[model samples]
Target: MSMVRAPWRGVKTPGVLRRAPAMVAFCAGLAVLLAGCATAAPSGAGQVADQGFVSGDGSVRTWDPGDRDGPVRVTGTAFDGQEIDTDDWDAEVLVLNTWYAACPPCRAEAPDLAAVAEQLEPDGVRFLGINTEDEAPTAQAFERTFTVPYPSIGDRSGRVVAELNGVVPLQAVPTTVVVDKDGMVAARVIGQIERSTLESLVEDVLAEEEPTGDGS
Candidate 1:
């Protein structure tokens, strides 16, 4: 009979040396624990109301009504004859208000808008007036008379006013739009916003930043 080597007695076969179920379980548990320890997901909405610039109804609403809608890009020359690019203005919120030197309501609210601008500027809010009807000289004169510190964009084409709400018929003189830092329209105001109302809204928008921490 052929001499047959005795089966290896000391060494175990490959299949016989399988890992223990406990070891596999421990490894899976460890992986899960490590995954759980990773950074938590970001929060949806912060507690602060001011930081929340965009309205729930999907319309940009702000203290100054007569603000523009759609995109927040300010393209063109200001009434002061200064070149204005929405990018250059350093503010988290933009107030785009439409006005005409000839309109009574526009004249009445000019001071209020100016005051709003002065109060909110320190907190990173910009107010831009759009002189939709008047020529450069008239708009300049109006600004001077009202002591409007913020620059006014010249929308002589009536195109910008048409883009805003509550001014479709071209009946309303003062309409405004609030633009969030992302260049998105946050709010729209269709008429004159009282000084107090405008200030409160601006405060609300500014307050939103306290909790969100600049939305970084």
Candidate 2:
């Protein structure tokens, strides 16, 4: 809950896409949550919400080191036609975000994510996007508008989503998964994330000692 402004926090939103949803986006109780989520996303969220993807509450979740899953397996070409294979990345931490061109929360959080990627990429923390929808032009337009600094895989086939099923519930368009050095999911933000919250999550993982392979 750090209120510290990210260096790029002042970035402006486009006039046409400026409708931000409630920050308390998701209902907490499972007893009534599903019913509540049926409503349309924020006006700017996307025209596709009517087609049935649910928006998530900005809830954060994490796994203990002992219970993590994967050295995740997946790969695909990015919007710019760059072939990215996670297996080949020499990063200590990997941040994977599931997004699309027009999700409201996605647009709202873009600047925060851009700043986080800028601040962390140089330190070996890799940020990748698995765009759940959108053609390269729409996705690239979003990236250009937001000044996003990382490459995103064009996951139009849902191939990457299938590959990462248990590690992430990617049905939510703006979900973000933070993977540890061993490629196991360390934390997740189930909706749009606050910059400080994301920074803290990545910093927490970045601070951990590489797991000792002593079979303890």
Candidate 3:
């Protein structure tokens, strides 16, 4: 019997396969470098997102009336176990903030947020808090410490964040989103929001004309 030579004896390893890991690592590094160099665009009559936070820059942004998205749908149980939903805020200005007591920025901006809530109450504006990483007791304690006038929804399940997908990215611990009277997303302040800046955003939303019968 004649022995047949192996057909695959002369095959060589491809260069790409040999260098695959290094090439993949180089591509990942390049992606990070490009992201770091990217500049954020300004929106809504010069509202700009400045330097982001240390965890990540939560850039601020505002949308024009025509560019605003439809009302966000959100609902959850408050830290005190009370039911809360965005339906109650229809046709009214609303502010929603994501926070956790342990976050420094969240702690730093609590007082300001509380103050803003107090100041805007008379204007019929409503505020809601989303505690993304805290239990009821911790959230309640933080509310007590900051004298918060609004009820915060316990978002440990991430339900609220999921509902706010298109409206707010919720990337930062202390992100704030302002909804116009029409229930549309009017503005967002990423990271720790300042008292004056938040106030201005609310005022801008409140100043917008009420939606006509067509929901303009």
Candidate 4:
């Protein structure tokens, strides 16, 4: 896996190393092996035995309704051989996560994600996963192991990641994108998300009023 250094231009993480060079080094070290030239970035270098857990820097980027870009177009096959697309998520808040079975941070945060999904789904929030490096069977096993309530798209073909391109710049595994009901990306957590952090972001999105038809 190869790593590229670049300044992440969004919200900033306070206290921790926030300089571009430091962030670049952070991205370089955590790159994961995947098919083609794709490399998944971990949240950081922190790790435990068998669990590459990296605590997130707690950087949250929230965009105003008018500042949101166009809805991201994503389509792929789920691990269960079901076709999935972002278009089907119309009029609902959706959470998109990038992860793989072997990613330590991904493993560590699986339960938190599942817990939040359960709490938010009834409120019209949806959760989707993008398994960056796993095949259907492996990805399915990971979900079962974690008891993840959401279905993940197996991105072995790399098409899904390619599609994400400018939409999210997918710099790290365990990155979370929270889209509002109108399909606008309302917020993003660029690393492993805590339950409280994710929950608070979703609540903020839910509280946003729908776009007014009148030019505001």
Candidate 5:
């Protein structure tokens, strides 16, 4: 008697066919992972990483904010006398400019920063000042003198200044960091930026915002 056996019992299909679903899934998952990675940089946003800074024959220092695992925690009073946590301020682009009332460069840049804050308000950017080397009274005076509309976070201990540079030594005043919506540092400018330059940089940052019909 001939035993009836399944015709395809032991025969294997082509490797590609056998693993088609897995391969497809792997490819799909890979695409998703890559997409997530690519989205790290917001579209139309200009990111100036540590590499962008001039090292000046390695004498000029640099820091990788990417290496920073989390947001730099800070607590201070706003110019309006309201307490603020650095994490609580929500905006697409965060401009953190370290200043002191006494520094000439800081004085020079205050108005530019104020203008930037005004121009970017409609575009969902938050411009904040960090008074790293000044007391509250001094900062208040500076704010009043410059007519700074945005809040200034008093960095009495200079920790925020140190953290922003990823532990790199900050030798200059008036350092500015442009942070993306994800709270990652996008660009760092170390010096007084002219009004035109400040405006241009702010425009570049605002350009990254995805337009919404509601002007909220």
Candidate 6:
């Protein structure tokens, strides 16, 4: 239940965004035409709503092996219509990234994340996005533009974010969380994730020995 919290990060994403200007433009146009995308409401007391968005300081946090909490028991349906339950996944590591279509940091990290996910898939690492905002078309457009290889759960009800907030401070727009084989939150990047950082975090968890059934 204890972790080392370090925050503040930035990444280069102009290049990635440039790769699909038309897709970004299309999503942006949709956002404008739709009035505005639904912003995520905090399911608790402290809600950071500045300019309709609040981004984490891109800091990273890590919990020690013995200090990690029990597994996260969250279930949600992805935009692709696939049912996802953390408890049911059999991967050695899971990466949960919180994002929406218009969030700058989210957009910035998308390509890097997709690449890292693909690179780490053979290591039995899985990637899933938890989007608390955005409709199906907007979310899917970004996915297609970025060539995102994984599914993103539609957390429009904020249920999934609330479930995650119980385990960590999720008061920001783009946060990347790394879960170990035990399904416990092992590490988190509070803002846009750098490709190397994500790789290292997942790799660190992947390197750990499997947990014994009796809690080691």
Model 2: worst 10 consecutive residues (lDDT sum)? 1-10
lDDT of 3 by residue, 22-60 (tens): 457544543332223212233332232354323434467
In the range 1-216, model 1's lDDT, one tens digit per residue, is 001011223422222114566446544543332222111112332122242221111122443333423344556677666777767878878777767776555676778899889988888998878775678888889988999999887765433443342122122346666666656555555555567766766666666556756667
| Per-prediction TM-score | 0.61, 0.72, 0.70, 0.71, 0.60, 0.72
In terms of lDDT, which candidate is stronger, 2 or 3? 2
Q: What's the lDDT for residue 167 in model 2?
A: 50
Scanning candidate 3 in windows of ten residues, the lowest lDDT window is: 1-10
- At residue 160, candidate 4 shows an lDDT of 55
Every candidate's lDDT: 0.56, 0.69, 0.67, 0.67, 0.55, 0.69
In candidate 4, which residue pairs clash?
52-104
* Stretches of model 3 off by over 4 angstroms after superposition: 1-58, 210-216
Cα displacement (Å) at residue 62, model 2: 0.4
Best-to-worst TM-score order: 2, 6, 4, 3, 1, 5
TM accuracy, model 1: 0.61
Candidate 4: segments with Cα more than 4 A from true spot: 1-58, 210-216
For 92-203, candidate 4 gives per-residue lDDT tens digits of 6888888888876677778999999998887888888988787778899999998999778876544455445345555566678887876667888766677888999998
Select the stronger candidate by TM-score from 4 and 5. Answer: 4
Winner on TM-score (3 vs 6): 6
CA RMSD per model (angstroms): 27.0, 13.9, 16.1, 9.4, 20.4, 13.7
Q: Model 1, residue 154: what's the lDDT?
A: 75
Cα distance off (Å), candidate 2, residue 171 = 3.7
lDDT of 5 by residue, 98-186 (tens): 66786655676678788778977877788777765566788889888988988887665444543443422234456666666655455
| Predicted structure 5: lDDT | 0.55
